[model samples]
Target: MYHESVMLNECLDGLNIRPDGVYVDVTFGGGGHSKAILARLGEKGKLLAFDQDPDAQQNAKLIDDKRFTFIEANFRYIKKYLRLYGIKQVDGILADFGISSHQIDEPTRGFSTRFDGDLDMRMNQKAEVSAFTVINKYPEDQLHKIFGMYGEIKNAKTLASAICSARMNAPIQTTGELKTILEKYAPKFKEFRYFAQVFQAIRIEVNQELEVIQEFLEQTPELLRDTESRLCIMTFHSLEDRLVKNYIKTGNFYGEPQKDIVYGTITKPLDAVSRKPIEASQEELARNNRSRSAKLRIATLSE
Candidate 1:
């Protein structure tokens, strides 16, 4: 089970890649973008790819090309990894931010609501925390906030109460087990969509995906070359999209505030490429349903 990169052609076109310049594919799932970058590069060009999942290494296809290098690490450490490789900056950086299809389709991976497996949703296997730990160990208040804030679920407090209460009877070990407990709290006549949302929230917290993206976005300007350095990010959910949108627009998660007479402030380090995000074309959406939620945002580092 491997992930098909969403909006593949559209992202490549947005990058405006230079044939002889260095590039980075930060979320190298299935190595789809990395492979495309490889095809577009000349012998003098280079592409560096990063993925925390070891399984992703098997999907990396450009091992034979000296122009390409794959690092088994998170994109949040892109600057560090690049520095270690004697590289300082890249012409373009592409990030497809979300869980891979491979993780969701594999039942044991437990990333999907449809799966009935252990509640282990660590994208990086080395991470100590998993959904099981969060569900069973986190305080009720923390769980309530995560569910309500990330999942945007109604009655988040009630749902949190149910989990805390049920786990005391028996440890919630698997997705199926947790689903059974949460289902009771779910409105009896409500659609299945609500339950799915709750599960998604848990997965997000378990992986610390939002925090990682926040760190990664903060470093893009420092990692890219001064002129025409493109940063393309594809986010599938509202929370993730909001972070990307704000960062691109104001160079901070919060919108920029007016300058005070007592303190001076400068403008952002990058400029938004489009006033709004670029959505996949109708043709692309029809071919891939997963593309439906994807919003692509691009920015150029200030020179």
Candidate 2:
């Protein structure tokens, strides 16, 4: 399978799709969600999907529905692209944020810790920065910050120092070479987790995933048609989930809300449909291990 859509039914239910309402799938990795959305839509309904990955573009090409349109750009520029398409607002927007299964399964992509590919983790292959550049060219302090902040890895400073020292011998060329260095610093029995964390950190930096997510989310309020419009996002890590949760609860990346001093009214663009994030069911967990860490949060425009 190119990618199995996690929480598929849950996501669809959260969307509460209208037969004739327009929708946007911001992360059209495998087109699984988009295909399902199309199935639920009427002839007049439209679905626009976005992906920067060339591989995904190919998958998108396989779909020949007149109601569907694929945008070959990053979702961060959602507003600009939508405006260009003459779409100012949509009924709902869905985002599944993280690396795709196809990217990880292909060793050349360098997204999986288990793979031995070139350290190239750019979501958009054309992007200048890659995991190779981050590991070999970044300064020790910058690496330290990336590992500590993005990966949430302890001893990040030590790991950064080790990377700087080792790369001086030669540029860290591949995932295997990087893993060899990481194995030394990884915890006694937690090497796999450590490697995943480090690779995730580097990947995040290379793709600027968090920044893109924020920019994308910031544009969603204006893009949504009204309070009935939904925004459903699935995040794989705390860093991503935090941003989504905070934005929904407070209308900013920060969890604190901005209040009007005169009337003491809190200003937030979106309201959470559920009090807490929704996780996969036991049945789904049994089928896909990747769904274990997945969290789904649904929101709507605040009144």
* Candidate with the greatest TM-score versus the true structure: 2
Model 2, span 1-303: residue lDDT tens: 899999999999999999999899999999999999999999999999999999999999999999999999999999999999999999999999967888999999999888899999999989999999999899999999999999999999999999999998999999999999999999999999999999899989999999999999999999999989999999999999999999999989989999989999998999999999999999999999999999999999998
* TM-scores for candidates 1 onward, in order: 0.95, 0.99
Against the true structure, whose lDDT is highest?
2
The residue-level lDDT of candidate 1 at 246 comes to: 85
By summed lDDT, which 10 consecutive residues of candidate 1 come out lowest? 257-266
Supply the TM-score for candidate 2.
Answer: 0.99
Query: What are the lDDT figures for the candidates, one per model?
Result: 0.86, 0.94
Whole-model lDDT, model 1: 0.86
Q: What is the Å distance of residue 95 in model 2 from its true position?
A: 0.1
Model 2 weakest lDDT span, ten residues long: 97-106
Clashes of each: 0, 0
